[model samples]
Target: MQGGAQLPLPNPDSTPAVPVSGHSANGAAPGPVVQAKESLLAAAAKARKEKPAETEAEKMLREEQEIMRNITSRKALKSVMENAQGISYTRNLKTGWKPPLKVRQLSEDQAQDLRDRFHIIVEGENLLPPILDFKDMKFPAPVLRQLASKNISRPTPIQMQGLPVILAGRDMIGVAFTGSGKTLVFALPLLMLSLQEEVRMPLEGGEGPVGMIVCPSRELARQTHEVIQGYITAMKEDGLPELRSLLVMGGIDMRTQTDALRRGVHVIVATPGRLKDLLHKKRMNLDVCKFLCLDEADRMVDMGFEEDIREVLSYFKAQRQTLMFSATMPMKIKAFAESALVDPVTVNVGRAGAANLDVIQEVEYVKQEAKLVYLLECLQKTAPPVLVFAEKTADVDDIHEYLLVKGVEAVAVHGGKDQEEREAAIDEFKAGKKDVLVATDVASKGLDFPDIQHVINYDMPDEIENYVHRIGRTGRCGKTGIATSFINKNQSESILLDLKHLLQEAKQRIPPVLTVLEDPLEELRELEKASGTRGCTYCGGLGHRIGDCPKLRSQNREQQRNTKDYFGSGGFGGET
Candidate 1:
């Protein structure tokens, strides 16, 4: 909090850091349910493509589309949706997005707060008028002095930790929740750095993105770009160069992005994969960028874009100050930060999943057969507009179908649906045309539905990080959100342990169910045998081999004990 003068930049060798995780770079098989959905989709695709005749271009496009269909990460899906240009192609590209805001732009008051924040950092003291740094940060004064303030009074722990390092122009990795204002950690520095250089127009040969942000998802990309624009534009009208920004995601026109790049912009926010495609084709350049950022880095690994991110990281100047931010620090992201940051400072804003603090979490252990009834009952009594999450596209479909049959107006969105359908469904939900949106994890990250009051985990996520992301969809922008999970009899102790850690950190109430259950996501052997799969290790895997087939083995051990009791003790066993 003291001596805010522009902090010194890190050693020259440092910078251009990106949160790089190998999770983004692999070829892995789909989850069992996802595999089943793929099978269902293959039949659906076959039926949809009834016409046998096709041009070579058409065939190639279809193949591309099929490959894209297999990618479910919202960011990956958005990359594809943003690329479709033809009418059907465009519709096909629709990875349902309703812009976060439509009416108002950044207010002058908001813009001034940004300027004042920068001044406070650069001078290590408030200019002329003079105020305490702690006080300035506490109430909206510094930022609110102007009209239309985008006031964020107090800096979160992460910001307080990294603001000095960023002002110093040092590379950094921030681990914090989605709503923790991690965006400003690097953004403020980059804006200040931009002020040091001469503002210029786009150059010829269609090159150079001065400030580029590589994000895991298009929704994040779009949102990040808009946030940057808001901050930069506010600076511009106040007498600085208007920060130009271009959005490059998966789905829209490549030509349009190319044109935007060629026309030149001050900053570019993009999805790693699509941005790679553009860069490989020499459609854009990173040579001039003095600053780079990789946001939602942990999620990128979840979406499988590590290689793309690495490749893109290579494009930036080695010394461009890099700022990498993520919600969690999994091994993959940690490795990326190690490789990408140059002796960078690591700032974690609060506990990584601290947003869980304001969230009230509950888990219900119910029979799968009774899931629908329980879900409906819970919503009818516990809350309204509960965001139900499923593990697979098929589950979303089944839930949607069942909800409709029960006269519940529910909407569903997944990777398998075309962009238009996804968009239509999302729009309907936003417009209140639908009461519940049954979705896969794609809806969990970077999408804001302010009125979302509750989140239902129909299928608990294998990764606890995902659980954090799902709960974030609600309780955003300073509001509280509730999350209820449905854990079946067969689920995992690991999940409970993870939940315990999250709950302890977030200050949320612990459900008594955490004490009684194994992994609900796990299947019982009996259930699996009956279903011709395997009983869930959680409930019994009917035949589904998950992780390493640990649940099934446990079930087998239980069976042996039963056999021992009958044969040795009762002397009436059928077999020893």
Candidate 2:
């Protein structure tokens, strides 16, 4: 082509010319193109020959998996050998535990007399006598000192019987009224067991905790952990080998808990969900956990933790001394105890679902719209350091805000709040900085708030058991307190009837509204009295007999629906 000139077009039928292979028409070698292709091929070959280095996280995970595999293998081998020898893994584990000769030497007459005096009823074979005083427990000096420091001079009815039962290494089912010192019954024994285990064989990394306490709520778990820590601190001060503990619950960093586990712990106080999560992830094992206490067992079951509890129990390779303690024992808890505990002694300090005698329960009829205004009046009925319980979180928040706007120093907690917020509210209320606390049912069970002058139910709970627990916040540790519950037309008659019976049982004044509600089972109860029997052996609800128990029927329906769903979802290969 001529420079700056147009070239002539070629014919359509003419043959096309081709350039040489790997060379441009400009007569230059394609060195760069060739090098680029070679570079790509070399890189592909290198990639095929070598693998990328693992990240730090991957390396740590692999190491953990390897360790877990080794541990599992060793456990399997031990189990197989033990099975072959027909030896029971847990038969000899608790042999070292024995009641003191003084406790054992008590005659049956004296034991019966003590039980009668304390109003304690114990059922089980080979039962030990109840301890009349804290000194009768023969606890370690540090433990006794801790008790003394708390000014706990004597054991309550439940503690009187429960201490001996647990200290003797017997599985137990403890039923008592709320605020009956049920915690110490199991807590002290757990500490003693952990100390005993540590003294015999110090725990190494991934070896323990020797004891575990499963609480129904995060707040309860934290409280139990603090209690154990107090005793642990006392023991350490007295020159005992230091014992480590961990609080495992949701709403906190898992890494912190995992790190604590890596260091080893002698006692673990945990909630079911978090504990099950860690156990499933292999972050902790129950191989060395011989003592397992289910605090607020009924509450846990009510919260739908029965399956999680069972799964956690399955992780144990050997039998564990299982203890179930609650203020109320429904049929479900009884069934659970039968399946979980081995020859458990049933220690009943008072009838299940009974109100605390020390609490003066006051019921009132207030319009639903006016409850907020009346809440302030209720607060005026008592001094500061009062607890107000509402059934819903939204109501709790509303009350909290209302109280604050009205110049009342109030803090609120519920399941909906962040963990930090909940903890802060509880801490403030506990530290006596807050005058009042508004909360949901989450705070109803197993929370120990000392010196709580009053508990006002802004709204009545649906279940009678919850009412018992809510009012139980006050009147703790042999102190008299008051519970003011406002009931309106919106309240359920069933709960109202139950409340009426509970008030009459506690010998408290019943409001006109509650008094007007007729008890459906009054005739049945009279007949039962004539028959030398009573109402609801299953749920302890005086309003209904066993066959008519709402809780029992509800649970049965739930189970049946679950079964139908399971089968319908192809759980088994069969036609519907």
Candidate 3:
């Protein structure tokens, strides 16, 4: 109980013995334990006292750093996964297996004469002689039969040059009139590429699509898919390895497309949007994609698919042959081609953006209110299978309804319609079940309605390029067709002037209304002749000069505005 009383000895039978050293029963020194506890407490107190409150800037920095870390982790994981998948799919594929370069070498004078015969202008290094006949290209027997089946006894001007350029494993920028059989130029080469890969080692699950065709619209994509499928079927029937082609586009169930990819597609005809989506989701890849065709590439860029196209290109695991085909070769396309293609052959069937000479472009001035009424009159000029293009969706619907009310067999397609409805309308029109296919510019680019007797622009498009494409729907595959445009005061004078020049260039009759308009491009044309240049080379717009290019100016203004906004919003840590 007291210090002195504790000195009494305990009973030896029941008491525990005390240690002689200054240590606890657990054998740890008590001084160090206490000192360590005190030190930790002191450090905690010191930290609390010395630490400053986090400022907003510091907090934001911390959050940004954390976000960056997470992003980096995800990217690393994706890179690893993509690498593994790439290796797996390309494992059995033979590397550097190029198709035999079966080009017909010709003298410069002979080549020039051949090009002149078809109105073709081929520009590139080591250019191959244009194939005068389909048989000269050494296409597979099946491909030739398919061509024959399609009634294509000879190569179109574009096919004449483009086929040789592409089949020689050369990247090409094919600029031709809209109906110049541009599809075959890329489609046939794509088949050869796919067959080469498939026969060597057939595609398995999670593997190919050795070739891809990117279209701006689902309709174009489906049409291209059908074209490829036809060739595939012909080849298969000829005892060649089966080549599977898949149509990848929006408005269809993604699962179906994914399943097809899983089943190993040898060729994919896809719209930019859906293809990018699938690539982003990792449901498909470009690991084995050796051939890339951008059909209606300018239209895709106009539809704001430039970023998507670039993003899709970033997904390619290997260097692939790229092909860009468009009716119009604006400066934008030229710039894009410069960056995307490797020493690409520029095969121009005619002057870029020229209206097909095969088309009879008849521009008639009509009052805006009278356009609908005049549409019927225009339709009477041609038989069934006419394409009526309007700029606005509402206008397309109105035209479709009016035609139907007038007992005209019409089907309408626009962005407003569901995918199924659009497909159905297009199919109906193509099948000749409908006399008129009323549509927006969606049907203008890269749609081959071979039998379209006429194309009537219910409303003139603002851009002459659209006019070219709309009129090009007819007069396809070497057939003469008529195009009647109802222009009114609502149409811009710039476009009217362009139309006048276009008609004059084609040697078509220009209306008095367009003739009355001042020729602003006349002086420009004279200057271009002096300098070996033509109207607004940037946009291929005949109405304006490069300095006055509306599109280029608009793009510049947008870029400046975006930069200003970015700085104004404290993008670089400036005060708002």
lDDT of 3 by residue, 1-576 (tens): 766566667777874545555687787865322321347889999999999988553453355435334423422111243445653221122233232344444577888898898889887787778777877777889988888888999988898888877877887898998888899899988888888888788899999879899998888898988998899999999999999999998888999989988989889999888888999999998888888899888788767777787778778877678898899987556665655566668999888999898888888878988888888888889778888888899988888888889999999999899999998888888887888889998888888898888888888887788889889998888899999888888877777877888888899998899888887555445446755556666567676555555666666556555554345556653443
Candidate with best lDDT: 2
Residue-level lDDT tens digits of model 2 in 155-214: 888988888788888888999987888888888888888888888889898778888999
True-structure Cα RMSD, model 2: 23.5
Give candidate 1's error at residue 174 in angstroms.
Answer: 0.6
lDDT for each candidate structure: 0.61, 0.81, 0.79
Arranged by lDDT with the best first, the candidates are 2, 3, 1
TM-score of each: 0.62, 0.80, 0.80
Whose TM-score is greatest here?
Answer: 2
Model 1: per-residue Cα lDDT over 1-576, one tens digit each: 477768777898875443243332244543322112347879888987996776553453355334333422222211222224311111111112111131124354653365455332211121112122323322122223321365555565556545545655566677766565667666655655554443444344455566778887665676667667777666766675545678887777899888888766667788887889988898887777777788876667656576576667556543466677776654334544555555555665444444445567776778888888888887764455668999999999999999999998899988888766877888788788889999998788767676788888998876566788898877765678788888765566655656654664566666776544354434333443444422112221122223334432454556565564444645664344
Output the worst ten-in-a-row residue range by lDDT, candidate 3.
71-80
Error of 2 at 497 (Å): 0.7
